[model samples]
Target: MAGANYTLEFGLEAATDDATIIARTVQEVDAALERVIAAASTFNHNPTAFVVERPRFGPLQFPDHGLKIDVDPRLGVAALAWVGPDFDCPWVTKSDRPVPGASLHKDIDSATPFPDDAAITLDQLRAAVHEFRESGGHRPKCVEWQEADGW
Candidate 1:
């Protein structure tokens, strides 16, 4: 939301409605759902009971916001939903394996405040993911680095 140059890119294969997707990406936000989805396994529910295919979103970038991020929140919701009970999609977070496990561990380490380490809240994770997504649009972090101020 910094500038008009905040370019949002979206990829839709089975999705024919790109406008709706874009709209949701920019305007709509649900704090309840957002807070509840604190991990990476909540998106794989097969309400159809036919087994849901794992979602694979590419590296998303927000150039103006300096936030490039991924979207996977199935695990946290599952935990919140069942606690000690068995979840329907045990293999949901298997989708997050490639970049989430080790990659996330390191990235979260770099982003968080320590001492209170190892305990990352939902908002923190959301912010980290948002930062990762919005860092690739067009605006580099230091726009004034090469400016001329008679220096």
Candidate 2:
């Protein structure tokens, strides 16, 4: 079977409404990510993060499969949430000790606090997103993941 088709969901300060971009190819996903990074880097920080998820098939779906990427361009780091079968696991770049006062996706009113040890650098985010696109929406193994408590 082919991998699940995916979509990118995000918001932009320049736009009155949120944006959703369907991605059927790796290039498309990359382009979307680049667009996201650009938007995130804007002085206003319109969208600090975005989500990549598998679209629901007519009658089949895997709500557990997807990733939430929180980007801090100024810091050159990003946090990844593997919202898959194992639940909202945060990628860990170091020990389990959470980053002090870590909060993600600030543009959204209900941004969730993440227990991420340390957000990966922009370069790593690129690799992880690439792996995710290639894997057809499966959890990317490009980095280490530590399960969050109560997740």
Candidate 3:
């Protein structure tokens, strides 16, 4: 499942409170925190190989105690928002899977299974941010319509 790429450029601090629900709810959260140890990782703010195609992932490449993947759960290739001059419309689109080219995770150079090099653009980044703000995380949730699904 290949799709668009997104870099948060920051990290969300551990949500610590006496709220037992949030604390003990998701086991992977703790694992995510531990793996994200150290500031250089941007507090795991930089999760390499985050496959955008699915909303939830598991046993991420860099596994430890526990793990899970929570993508936006939206279907659609990460596209350029086309908001500014920096934007470039893609040749391969959300409707088409990218022909193998650069490795998505090529930049990380670490222990991870996700290929990091996704064909994405600045406008898409901007759009994701704006949408994330408007909604809670960018894009609408849907089981992407695969060609096999009659797309």
TM-score for each of the candidates: 0.25, 0.62, 0.27
Q: Give the CA lDDT, 0 to 100, for residue 33 in model 3.
A: 30
Cα displacement (angstroms), candidate 3, residue 39, comes to 14
Tens-digit lDDT track for model 1 on 40-142? 2332221111001212234762111122222334323111100001222211111222232221221232432111122233444444323222432322232
Best by lDDT: 2
In the predicted model 2, the residue pairs found to clash are: none
The TM-score measured for candidate 3 stands at 0.27
The superposed Cα distance between candidate 2 and the true structure at residue 3, in angstroms, equals: 8.4
The digit string of per-residue lDDT tens for model 2 on 72-140 reads: 666556666665544445443333444454444522345444455756667777777766666655666
Candidate 2 stretches greater than 4 Å from native: 1-17, 41-62, 86-108, 149-151
The per-model lDDT (C-alpha) reads 0.23, 0.54, 0.25
Which ranking of candidates, highest lDDT first?
2, 3, 1
Report the CA-based lDDT of candidate 3 relative to the real structure.
Answer: 0.25
lDDT, candidate 1, residue 47?
10
TM-score pick, better of 1 and 3: 3
